[model samples]
Target: MRKKLPLGVSLFAMLLLLSSQAFAAPQSELWPTWDNSNESNSATFDHSQWQHLLDRYLTEEGQHTLFNYGAVSSQDKAVLEQYLTDLTSLDPRNYRQSEQFAYWVNLYNALTVKVILDEYPIKSITKLGGFLSFGPWDDKATTVAGQSLTLNDIEHRILRPIWNDSRIHYAVNCASLGCPNLAKTAFTAENTESLLDAAATQFTNSEKGASVDGNTLTLSSIYEWYGVDFGDNEQAILKQIDVYRDGKPLKGWSGKIQYDYDWSLNKP
Candidate 1:
């Protein structure tokens, strides 16, 4: 009646399918509700709690910043939960654009950490998803201003679309080794610009972000996944990268361009 493929062939096919899904990025489409911001509003949002969590748990190991997911105590976890609750309770629409940017970035990162800690001792963040899901990104992580928002919603729908800044790719950390380093300090309206530039520079120079070999230019899957955010073509992408790259700039590369990402947990 039906024929089955060999075990080896089936395994290979499955791996290929998983790989394809892993690199798939969502498009940046605006959610009009989040587009409202008050330039005249001079209010400030507090993020010291998030910074405290980061200072205690996040550390630099080699070029990557690893979070101590396993070592976080129950008390600290409760504190984290409180911080997230306080963040989502407010309406960001009434805040200034600068403050709103910091709020979303901090919220996105905190929610990601909470997700991992809720189910620690895992090898990769990708494993948190369901049978057909690649990650917990699409799952409703938090409710902001009575609007249920997922990690994808905060990133793709809000931050990317509202700000329309390519540097945002460096701001939102995904709690993975391949993702950009989570900032050591919490972002504030005053520090967001500097933090964004610092992250871009650090990631562009690191091996996990971009590397060149003889004739080949290999990059993190982030560039390929969100290529449109980073200029949408090889030359344009390289140009944007060069702006942050420290050493000799990457010039013409007529050879193959490759992209790879590590889904492993960013933890010590």
Candidate 2:
């Protein structure tokens, strides 16, 4: 004979079941590694030229920053092209862990900017084509260490898998207003940790990041999509966001979660 549960107990059990399903483990496997352990120190990569260009083109506002994509001069563009060439020419596996981390991050951002420049006056990054007319993420954008790779490769295969840090999402911008604001300076090996923390903090605190109202919580689609990277469940995800939120209220944030994103070019 089966004993029927009480109504309140049944409702509580149902809620728990829904919660478990809602925050299921991420489908993708995350394997963290630092490719070059034999190297003691990171090689100094010259990003001053890139820094100079960013200073001239990146405009900062109260909460977010924008890039003056239309203002990049041909001479400046040449410098960027040369930078990418130099980066691609190097053997990434030869660099130290810190160096390689910064290298991949900078390479990804530089390439994103280049793609946007190549298709400037366009509405959004999705306009760029990938396999089957998707975004340019899967397009073979560059070669590194004698291997042809795409933006998706640099991010998902290399950075995300190697570092296993959810912060990588904030570091690599998609040249969209919905993405994290592009840092005004180049990410150097020395400054990489601090810069990453700053980026996460900034993004989590922004209106585009998340907001709590009454019993409802609204968050970026990023959290919804990459929720596993942040935490095992919504509670864990909210806790991670609070870490970078610097004393912001995430506790008692229950009920519903909403997501929003903007795909427009982040231009000034």
Task: Estimate the TM-score of every prediction.
Answer: 0.93, 0.85
Clashes of 2: 0
Q: Write the per-residue lDDT of candidate 2 for residues 104-182, one digit (tens) a residue.
A: 8999999999999998888888778742343588688998767788887888778887788999989999888888889
What is residue 176's positional error in candidate 2, in angstroms? 0.7
Worst 10 residues of 1 by lDDT: 246-255
Model 1: per-residue Cα lDDT over 1-268, one tens digit each: 6899999999999988987776678999999999998889998988988998998999999999999998998899998999998888899999998899999999999999999998888998888877767889999999987899999999999999999998999989888999999899999999998999999999999999898898878899888889899886888988899999988777566788899888889998
Model 1: runs farther than 4 Å from truth? 1-19
- Clashes (backbone N, CA, C under 3 Å), per candidate, total 0, 0
